[model samples]
Target: MDIRFDGKVAIVTGAARGIGYVCAEMLVESGAKVAIVDILADTLAEAVETLGKKGTVKGYQLDLTKVEDIAPTVSKIREEMGEIDVLIQVAGILAGNPAEKITVAEWDKVMNVNSRSVFFMMQAVTGQSMIPRKSGSIVNFASIAGIRGMKEPLCSAHYSASKGAVVQLTQQGAVEWAKHDIRVNAVAPGGVLTNAMKSAPPEMLKNAIEPIPLKRLSKPEDIAAGVCFLASDVAANMITGQTLIIDGGGAVVGV
Candidate 1:
């Protein structure tokens, strides 16, 4: 498809590395002025250096889990950038501690960063820009774990619960904003090879692969391609409050 995002502006969070990086790269390549946000200053700078030469790409090193740090940054971007045409929320973490063994700190850390921060970011940006313009696309990253129970405990229960909240958050945001023409959707990846998944246990890997018809883990670029489609108007116009599960047909089979 000749999907070109010319004259558009995009903001990708947690873009220092992993899937977020490729999402930013693809958007820039398709002619969008992309701004990458992450807490890791060093990696964010490296990403900027690599992508800056391509288009109007810039980097913001801010803690997404903290609400106070994001507002000024968004305002500054507004002054500098024309408008935020697309918002891709890729900032999250996953750590596994068995349900019975999970700590309060662990649960808070997962929920605070994964679900709470994402909601705040959406509120900050969409309330300021999207609600005003009445036109924007918000793509959230949810996992198959959120869609269904993991065959093995891959991440802490908090991680899965937080992502489940993300699915609902997308729905609420989409339903509330569709009147204004804003589209809020999510993509649930089954077994994408992200930085966090590099250390998955053998049993976990075996279970994850067993259900997939492809019998393979997806690449970051694979998910990025889906993000691109959701961001673009070609694949959908009236699409909102929906989730596209790219699970290699693993999610469809039931006993």
Candidate 2:
């Protein structure tokens, strides 16, 4: 299917690198005017510069953990890029510590970025743009860790909890906003081979890939394809409150 955004505008958070970056690039390639957001200013600038060559792309450097900053940032994007037609919340963090040893600060940090900010961003964007317009699509980043427990060394209780929150949030948002023609869904990925995963300890990487039926880690493009499908109004018009798992069949084997 040749999905296209044409004249739409999209906001993609955590788009400085990894799966987030690929999603933003695909949106641009599909003809959407994209606002790529990230806390990493330098990296975001580079991404903006590179994506600019392909289509209309802009970078916004804002820390999603700062809940207070979300509303204003959304407002700026609306004013600069036009009312957002699509939102892809991909900003998240994974800190691995045993549940028993997890500090309050560490737990809070993960939740703040992965769960809380996601809610507020949706609230701000929908209230200010989509709700008023009565049309939009949102895709949140969930994880396989959220869907099921993992025995991997890097799986942290807080990270899993945060993603679980995301899954619930996506469902609630989908139901609540369906009246306004807004669709909310999530993509749960397992062991994606992004830059961070590339630098992971050999044992950790091996552990991640061993259980998948496909016996391979997902590429960033793999997850991006799912995200773009969810974000497409035409393609996913009837899809909502769903968590599309792009785990290379790991979930099927109970990994």
**Leading candidate by lDDT:** 2
Candidate 2, poorest ten consecutive residues by summed lDDT: 146-155
Residue 48 in model 1: lDDT:
97
Error of 2 at 116 (Å): 0.3
- Model 2 Cα displacement at 70 (Å)? 0.6
- Runs of candidate 1 with Cα error greater than 4 angstroms are 195-207
Q: What is the lDDT of candidate 1?
A: 0.85
The digit string of per-residue lDDT tens for model 2 on 1-255 reads 999999999999999998999999999999999999899999999999999999999999999989999999999999999999999999999778888899999999999999999999999999999999999999999999899886757669999999999999999999999999999999999889998889989987888789899999999999999999999989999999999999999899898
TM-scores for every predicted model = 0.94, 0.98
Alpha carbon lDDT at 162, candidate 1? 90
Candidate 2 is scored at a TM of: 0.98
In candidate 1, residue 215 scores what lDDT?
Answer: 83
C-alpha lDDT score of every prediction, in listed order? 0.85, 0.94
Clashes of 1: 0
Tell me the RMSD of model 1 versus the true structure: 1.9
